[model samples]
Target: MLPAIIASSRIVFADDALDIVQGDRIQAEIDALRMEIDDLRDERDEASLDATRRTEIRRLITDVVADAEMRTNRIDRPWNVIASADGDFTLEADVIMQYDWVLNSTSSEPTRYGFSLDTLWLSLGGTMFGPKWSYGVCAAVGSDGTFIPEYAYVQHQFEDGLFVQAGILSEYFSIEQAINPNEQLGTSLSFVAGQFDAGQPEGILVGRQFDQWRFWSTLSNGWGQSYIDPLENQRTGVMTRVELKPFGDWNTLYMFNPYPGLVDRGLLFGFGGSFDWGDYAAGTGRSISGDATRATADVSWQQDGVGLMAAAYYQDVPVSQTDGGRRWAAVAQGAFFPVSTWDVYARGEWGAVENGSRSDFAMATIGTSWIPAGDSRLKVVFELVRSWGSTADWSVDGDIGILSTDGDQTVFRTQLQFAF
Candidate 1:
């Protein structure tokens, strides 16, 4: 019976041992062995065994049980978090697919309602020497199905509270720019933050966390700011961001907070400023030198399930080798969580060029984010936008071409996001 059982389980035993086996069938084999021992040691002595033989059976059974228990107790990590047991290296990956439908009456173009591929991308990370050192990479599909590299960088950590990253990185100049789309409450970002501030340059950034103070600074090639090959990136761009968490736990200070529970009830104050001289470089454009600078201040607070945030920014960008006027933008955003996984939010955003000398555009938006399974990685968001006032130079803000030709418009957007 013992040989038959081992044969059926495909378990090969050591020369001096019974067998080595693990996995779900282990417990069954253990139970059967125990029953055999009980029968062998019956008080009636009909099937009694010698003490030496009985001890050997118990020992082998113990080894099998221990191996089974060890295997069963091992942690099962998610598919995205790949790591080695020795803490030497790890990797993680995620895929994001998004679709956008913008229904609006356009003053510059015809009324439009259609489905567009907003974003289809991949996020991947590799850590060579543990969490203290890693690299991040992202790529997105373009309208023509071409692959565009969004981020590629290396991050290193130091013991004295300093960390550094070098790569093609996004500007740390605005609240909206600091977070990814899925981490944001609205489908569309504030016009100003999306347009004038959405520059991803190849550079290096350093950051530190001390008590409640978090500081970050960057010096980079300002990749998208130049059109000239090697000569276009001659100028270095500088940026700095500082934040203070007066009441929250330091660990939560950098969390992608889509809701209030992401951190303890508290307040945060932040500022970001940057200055660079280079052409907005990319594709097949001529590299023309120009000045680009931005400054912003923001405050955020959350208590219970309610949260509020406000930010203001000023930007001066050069175009056509001419000094363009400064652009200003602001937003007052708030959210309420009737239920922990559901939130209702509203935001009022406005932007203008150089003290409103040109023209101004103000947008009001109402939106909600729902996490059906209480998973932060999977989120569904919907937003309604109404814009009034007027915009003369759509380039005054950073909204990619969504607000290209603008006047008064209404927009409806919904997005479903998932990670891992």
Candidate 2:
């Protein structure tokens, strides 16, 4: 009986101790759950504060940028002197100057060396009313301080990509003549190219561009005519040109040398023709009667560090004119870069006149150019040109000097050009 009672006491004591341990464990679990809830509330508060700060920062940035854009539409430049607040009107100016030191050795004329101002071009142009309407006036200052008017025209581009301009305009037949003088590959244009180019004329031009194709036609007073030319010497003329760009940007094609960061590869083909008819005296007091027609075809290709240009020209002149006959010419030019900002180029030209004299001539030029500090605004060029064959009875551009001798002639030129 004693043993059984002892056993029962022991069992009851064990049950009480187990109940106390289970209650302590339950209290500890409840405290831990409460702490977790407190941590979640703290995190939520921090996240709300961060989101409010971010919103405020974004609002401040937006306000500052809006104010800046409203003050200046971001198109203002040193050349852009005048502008409208709504970004619809603006005015711009540009200038280019080129100086040359030339040394010539001709068989007939004594070797001579002289320095001359080649070109001083100034332009003022900008958009009016809207981006589609624009006007420009350009002029050149000769070495003798003569004011040579270049281009003065107002142009409008329609939504369908057609444009029309009226005033003093260029012939736009030869790519070499169409490019700015400062951008030419050599010191001067090839002799053959200069012979066929019609110079600038006062006229009306209509043009259209779509995708990779472009066409322009001009009805002008006549070849080599200008605003100041006398009316008695004027004649009716029409010129037309077409261009097809397989690939590449049109603006880049104007430059003979590859510019910095030139990564484009393109091929371009151009063809042009002109006709003039009247019985009038030319500006140079030369008689120009009957009809004349000029035709030209050119191609240009550029890729990587190399560029090439070639052109062929043909003209049919009135038999009444001196040295008049079917004249034809061809020119080819190539350029390559040995390094960025430096270029080496070569050009060759050949032409013939099927007249009483039947003059035939050929010219070759080699040159190198350097752009200091990779700055295209400034350039220095050195060139050596050689001409040979029957050079008599041919008139190249007067500005480049006369090649009188029939024998071979040599010329060396050093040039400095600046543009802004």
Candidate 3:
């Protein structure tokens, strides 16, 4: 009996020890589960922090890129916005001021001197919808107390090299003047320019532009300087030009061709001519009237640092109570530049006006212009003028008249101009 009792106690003790070992294993499993939960929480928090930092970095980079682009691409005011799809628009503005001094050798009129706002131009242009359609507008404040709409037009490309432009556009005769506004040699229009002005009717113009050529014609009111109807009569005219570039063998010469130069340079030769007829009546009674016709030709050559140009014009004026009148004029200009920023230029012009009832008068002008820092768009010019003929009453002396009768006299002038 004693042996059996001892065996039972041993069995009981062994069973209890086994139960204790199983309980300890359950506790260890609970501890391990808690540690796993804590690790998962730490991982989720770390991931959230990393994602937030990445998002902040992306936002910072995006803002920086947009700001830089704005600075590089914006222009002047009024027409600030162009086309905006994929950033396909542009804006621009130009301002100019000039100071001039005139010394009249025949008149003593206080030696007229003054400063003037030569031009203030604002322009906007861009493409829209696709690359095929483009538009532009240019407005200006003129020195002669006038506001001019310089250009407003839309152009469409139908195919490879053909395009059409229609609007109140520039006449072909005036295109060169518009492009090289800063390089005009004098304060007023040249003799040939005046004649062409009568021939160049300003209104609606149609133009075609190709790889190396452009042709344009216009139907406009023929009154020359007077834009008002009461002061001038209307007329009709047409103008055209053709330009060509040859020498496919000379690539080096092509780079600095004078015809196209820094702006419209190429092997450039162009022919421009115009014809016009108009009628003008004097006084309240239509009793006295005049009819006029004008024609002109322009030829130019340019290469590298040298440029040469000549223009001639003729006008026929027939009026009542006065004999038929005629006028002829010619202008020649040459320029040389050893460097890009400096240029020396000279121009000569001669003009004559005659009528059977009135004595013939002639005018001549010689001028030189200098551009010291050519890139600044600053220029200085000096002009000496002499007038002679039967009716030479056009001479001035320091803003005062010296000789009242027909004779010869000299005039001196200096002009300084800046553009931006």
Candidate 4:
């Protein structure tokens, strides 16, 4: 009936010819359906023109199989998809939110609101079998709300400049509290730069690089600080660091180039100081804790876009009986960046407990930060604090009494952050 509908048409069409059906109008509609099947074989009328040419060739193959199943269901549906391959391994995630506003100028009710979940963070870093061993794991959501583990690490490279690291990481202390946690301007921890409450211990660290000098060392356990405890005792501690650049170009000052469009002048100087003497006992011994000493000293500088840092700390407590007491603390900080997302900061601290009757402390803070779009993952900060001791108790003015009746207490804070 038109060559039996093109020999029982099974539709295997892909040699590309019918550019949308105009090959001389499909050969003049198959030559007018073979002259109407030879005029119905000369008058029997070939069963009504073979049922109207097999219903117009089954409606043109059901409209070309419904437009190829609507473009294969819009490319196998999956909201905004992206997958990778070619040396594999790629994963990422980050979600963080924070808000804090506290003002209590002697509480005639100034303002107070604090919300945190500051980081729901989960990141499983990559690069393996190729970049001389690189690995990472950063987890979050803790402060007792569970899911701890922050930064499980591995980094190894050996030859000349040497390198090594093993398990649970991050302890090189205060490079803006260990490398910018969203550009921290403040939201706690200035009782003299000392809160990262540990966590991530089970260690080994070694580093070396010569020419513009660099060095490193570490040993751990010393009572796991955070992440809700990780075997709290069996005291151990050690740390050492040294760095110097003095302009001999370590890849233009340790590689982080930017300037074509501005922002990134070079200069870096360094030193990191640490010490921890140990043997501690306090599970409720009433009064008797052995040898505990802490030490710190730091200096930093950055050029062009401007950045400067400073640090100091000292702690020694050896009170086993009435007349044997000692305690000490100190802190200092500074920051500036007239643009490149803006920033300004200041800090000061002091502490004491010699001959204890609890009344030695001092604090000061000043801050500002605005990231607008320079995207340190979005940030905004404002801080002003002035605390005066009685051995300052925790936070929120040590939960009221304004540090023993307003001898000195002033606070104003603002924070808004989002990281993802």
Query: Considering every candidate listed, which one attains the maximal TM-score?
Result: 2
lDDT of 4 by residue, 261-306 (tens): 2334444455555444543344745323355455565555445544
Q: Which stretches of candidate 3 lie over 4 Å from their true place?
A: 1-58, 64-87, 107-111, 143-146, 174-179, 186-189, 198-202, 210-212, 223-236, 244-269, 275-292, 317-325, 338-342, 354-368, 389-409
**lDDT tens readout by residue for model 3, 298-325:** 6555566666666676667553423225
Taking all chains together, each candidate's TM-score versus the true structure is 0.74, 0.79, 0.64, 0.27
Question: Where does the lowest 10-residue lDDT sum fall in candidate 4?
Answer: 393-402
| Candidate 1: C-alpha lDDT | 0.69
Model 4: what TM-score? 0.27
Candidate 1 residues lying further than 4 Å off, grouped into runs, are 1-76, 107-109, 226-228, 250-262, 278-285, 319-323, 355-357, 396-401
Off by over 4 Å in 2: 1-81, 228-234, 281-286, 356-358, 373-375, 398-402
RMSD of each candidate? Answer: 17.5, 15.0, 8.1, 24.5
Query: Pairing residues by index, what is the TM-score of model 1?
Result: 0.74
Q: Sort every candidate by TM-score, greatest first.
A: 2, 1, 3, 4
Task: Give model 2's TM-score versus the native structure.
Answer: 0.79
**At residue 270, what lDDT does model 2 achieve?**
94
Residue 295, model 1: Cα distance from true site in angstroms: 0.7
Model 2 pairs whose backbones collide: none
